[model samples]
Target: MDVCVCTPQEWDTIRSQRADALDASLESLGAQPVPPVFHTTAAPDPSPFGIQNDSDSERDPDDIPIFGEQLHAPSQSPTDTLRNITRSVRLNVNGVPRDRSTWKTLRDFVDERTIEDVLDTIESDRNALDDILARTSDYPESLSNTIAAIEGSVPAENTLPSMQDIFQAQGIASTDMASHLESLAAHFEQMSTALEHHEAGETFVHEDLHDWGTTWAEMNRDTEELPAILSEMEERLVSIDAAQWVPVLSQSRELSNVNRHSTKLVATKRTAQQNLDAHRRILDDLDELGEIMSEMLERQQAVEDEAREHVALLHHHIVTIEDLQHRFTSYQYAYSKLLLELARRRQYRDASDRIVNGMIAQLNAMTEGTFSSPQSQASTHEPEHGQYLPEDVCLFVQNAPTRWNVVPHNQELEVLPEIDSDLLDDARLRVGTGVAALGASQSL
Candidate 1:
């Protein structure tokens, strides 16, 4: 019959060694050796505005300007020009009045002097005139033309016009200038209010454009970094896929099954231990009964030598025999129960053996012939090959039968020495002639 060959200690040792080896191999497979650390000097910073400082040949081939001169050029539309003019006027007089002293200079010069007097004054002070003209040249052509007309109107007599004429001219010119300045101031105020409203309207638009540019820059940065981020994510996914998840899950399931089996085995062991204790108690009772029976037999023999106590002794012997019969019946019942328990234990053992054999087969399959079966170890100790028993089989000797005997036939029986005539007669009186003769023949 097949049986487990390895002792508990041997199995534990084997499993521990295999487990250690597996751990080492897994460590080798999972370990990522530290790469050599190389010290690198920092690279130069890129230009803040994204424009490369490199020469034309060294510049990135992919870099291209997004904005050209045309994108920043002023608009040609009359409406756009009007808007620009209004914005400029508003900016120039943001915190001051449109009719302030700075603007009164033109009206004052025209009011205080005639066309001729202003020319003589400018010619007499040419250096100051040069400075004023130099600063005033930026004004409109109309203003310049008015200045030239005043210079040409200068009298050849080099004398001022009459006070009466000057006053009349000043009154007319000042009234005209004041009227024009008032109109201009009113127009400036209207344009300034309109520009303020227009600028308010454009505020959100400008902010939106700024935000869009910022978003575009952020998107560009993210696009540049996308490849490395994707690569890292892909590597992590691959590592997850490459992990021994299936094997680990399978092992976990197997361990759970083992635990369940171990629980059942523990219950079985408890039952076996109880039965063993019961057997020990029965054996102790049997031993005590045997001693009692020996003493009773000695008392019966002692009484057989006393004729006066023969009747009482006979009565006592009969009672002792009945008690002995009852004890024997109890022993028989206990032995039957023990035998039944032994049968159940043998069945359990057989199931365990089957389980172990299946595991061994699985182990062999998994290892792909790298590991040998225990049966191979059992075959090395045939009587023809060696005197020593197989190690695995020897381990079983402590619990298994050492030797077996077959029942012999009449012809195979050996002759025995003759029994005494008196003893033969006494056995015949107790067992009857036919049984005595059968026993005698069997002995012979």
Candidate 2:
């Protein structure tokens, strides 16, 4: 069965028609009645109730049959008779000429349209509530498992603290993980729902996946940004602490004399005096050696003077041999002339040639003998070969000595050899002086 409820416009139209009918009836009965103009004046305006003036606006309440339509007694419209209108009017029967008419008119205008709309709104709200309840009831087991896994994966340090621990640590009484999550949990709840919807391939009204991704991205960005700043700050604090360490350490450890050691200085006195006494003895020995060197030097000088005189005497004997060779050549030339004169008479030519040739041969033999002999070497001893051959030559040879003595450059003249006649006539005079001296020195 299709049941129809009357709206307020329908109720008001029905009430107006009923009131007109009653007035018509009372007027026909000849009782002093409400005037027709007054009835028009008394009718309620539908404008305030959001009701439109159209063909559907005016109709009789009983004309459409429904339950509860008889409360406006003589009018027969349920809206005209409802007590809520009477209560809103706050009126008594004494003020109106037709009490029933006013009562019916007020009752008819009891907002039936608003009531119908309210009922429709309530039915729709109920359906919406039922749909939400069904969706929540069928929440996927997979979604629950995913949530459990994600929660379980977090480490102990990252996980929220227990209720008692949070209270102790933060000094907040009765605070818990749920209390902390209250501010942000709705966003995660929404994200979880959207992720499920997206996985299911359903067209979601809100992009919960995008919201979840953005939230996770922001969380990761914060995680990345915070530690780098904190690390830098921690390093700066470490450097600051390091800067203060040297003074603190020096203050804790004081200076001490444990690092020092003893050293001694000694001076010796006897060594200098001993060295001086030794040096004096060395000087006395050197002076004695110098005197001996002076005596040896005088003997060396005498030997050198004698050697020079011997060389001069050898030079004088060479000059005398040159003079003897000149005189011998002259005597040979005179004897050859005498041989030529005897050969011209032819009386003893051969004998003359022999005698002349023999003389020249003898002269040549004497000249060669003198030239080859060590005549200069004989000056170092007695000149034994320079002694007499003829009486006059012997006299010259005997008087000329073989050795002489040289004078010093600072002194007078050379000392000539002395020959004593009596000494020349002595028995040693006939002996070669070098052999005789050698024999006599050997005998001694």
TM-score of each: 0.14, 0.15
Prediction-by-prediction clash tally: 0, 8
Best by lDDT: 1
lDDT string, candidate 1, 141-236, tens digits? 644554465444443332323546534543554455445446546545644654676688855354653554434355446556556654543333
CA lDDT, every model vs. true structure:
0.38, 0.37
Q: Which lDDT tens digits does candidate 2 get at residues 1-444?
A: 112234324533543543343334223222222211112222333211223333454664312211122222133343442333343334323223233343232123333454345335534543443443343343345346545654554433323224454234433311332343452465456556657877989874335436545555664465465556444433333323233332432454333211111100001123344545655655565575457557645654564454344334333322322222222222222223323332344435445556767776776666555533344434522355545344445344223222223333665222211222232333233233334433432332
Which runs of model 2 end up more than 4 angstroms from their true locations? 1-279, 306-311, 327-444
Candidate 2 pairs with clashing backbones: 8-113, 14-59, 14-61, 79-107, 79-108, 80-107, 80-108, 388-394
lDDT value, candidate 2, whole model = 0.37
